[model samples]
Target: MQVDALTLSKFQGAAEPNERLPMKVLGQDDFLQLLVEQMRNQDPLAPVQDTEFIAQMAQFTSLEQSRQMSDDMKLLRAQASFQQGVDLLNKEVTVQVGEEEPPITGTATELEMVDGEPKLLINGVFYALQDVIHVKAMDGSNESQSKE
Candidate 1:
């Protein structure tokens, strides 16, 4: 008996024509399942060598580690971005909203996460952290004078 490799088309067969298919990357579980199936269906007369099985197990372990590292890096990046946004709070900032439009300058009032990315609220508008061009501490004297 021969086993066929899994493909994305197999998963999309029941979907509507107009619907979009999500891209799926095979992870550790999928890899382990394939390895188990291969072992179960191997020829009795020509059994797989011990070294080959060991090699496959090693490969699976490496794949799992790589996936974990990727997840950790993504989390680290998000935290760093959020920290940068927090540091900007209550500070005056200059941001470029568009190429043709003039830069907007305002005090960073709030920090929010939009679509899993950090955004800084300024003058009732949300701007991405990357768009910020300059940052300065608000003057204490000016704030006190304005209160009167």
Candidate 2:
């Protein structure tokens, strides 16, 4: 196949005025497309080896698995945070609202998710889980209390 100037320009990252720019990150589909293009453009006399192709496929699979693991980890963390907030319900907690303001001590009345993060309702006010400095069990038993 004879390569034309227009086709060469496309490979050179040249785009038309109205065309959208290429994505910053190459997705699985993009990787497959590039692989196919490489195979199509390779010289028939010296084609890509089977081992090389297999290696590429392995790399692609690894990338996909890593992405899935990352998503799963995020979900796990979110669920754990939510569980922590739920456990605090009806339990007295000391929350530092701000640097200058005094810490407020109140029972965690409700648990809510604000912007995908767990928030505890204490003294009719919603505060992030990080703001809670200390927690005290209502049953007079000393439980896990975070102080700092």
Candidate 3:
């Protein structure tokens, strides 16, 4: 019988009770089931030894552990990349807000950093991530004049 990827994944160990129908993760049960099935269908004179079974199980365990570790590492890397992107955007001089290209006008009032994102307080109005465009630091002279 030919088992496709989807079919193989859903099949719990043939040795495992029906109550334990679905295997949570690829594990020893699956390996044992495959081994049992192979022996059951093998020639009457030919049998797989215990040593071979142990070796195969060891190899499967190592492979499964490595796969799980690699998946975790990938998730960490993705999170780090996302954080770096956010940092770069926070330090940017300009930001694209949606498809609406509002003309770059008005002076920035208060510089607000919300959720690690820098948003401009423009024309005494607060802007969100999708509202602001050009953002620059106010010169000391401009700040002084504005204060006056």
Candidate 4:
């Protein structure tokens, strides 16, 4: 019996009865399940040696570390974006509303969550952080001049 990657992934993360997960990703439980499945389906004549199993365990640890790093990166990126939005408060900004439109200048009066993206409120108009190409102090200085 040959197990494909898609089949193995689907079979690994299934929850037992009385278990509930609003969001489920492959974790230690799934890793152990995969290991068990590997052991179960191995040839009886040439069973996996202890050293190979240990290597698989080490690989699982590496997988876990990679997942943690990925999650950390996502958190760092979100923090940076929110900090950028927060930095814009009460500061003069040059916002590019459209590809063809000229850059509009105004004080960022507020920041709001729209479509899960940070938007800057400039003189009653909302501009996406992605659209704002430049940021500077309100006083024409190069540093963040005010938090208010």
List model 3 lDDT by residue over 47-123, tens digit each. 77778878987899899899889999977865664453343232323434556664444554455555545555545
- Model 4, CA-based lDDT: 0.81
> Which is the better candidate, 3 or 4, if ranked by TM-score?
4
Which of 1 and 3 is ahead in TM-score? 1
Which digits, one per residue and each the tens of the lDDT, describe model 2 over residues 28-88? 9999999999999999999999899999999999999999999999999999999999999
The prediction achieving the highest lDDT against the true structure is: 2
lDDT tens digits by residue: candidate 4, 1-148: 6787546757888555356656566779988999999999999999999899999999989999998999999878877887889988988877777778988878899998775678999878998887776667867776643222
Instruction: Give the clashing residue pairs of candidate 3, or none.
Output: none
Q: Candidate 1, 32: how far from true, in Å?
A: 1.9
Q: What ordering of candidates by TM-score runs from best to worst? A: 2, 1, 4, 3
Q: TM-score of every model?
A: 0.77, 0.82, 0.40, 0.68
Clashing pairs in 4: none
lDDT of each: 0.82, 0.90, 0.56, 0.81
**Please, what are the lDDT tens digits per residue for candidate 1 over residues 1-115?**
3333335445657656567656588777778799899999999999999899899889888888998999999999999999989988998877887788888889999999987
Models, CA RMSD each = 9.9, 10.6, 13.1, 10.1
Runs in model 2 deviating more than 4 A are: 1-22
Which candidate, 2 or 3, would have the higher TM-score against the true structure? 2
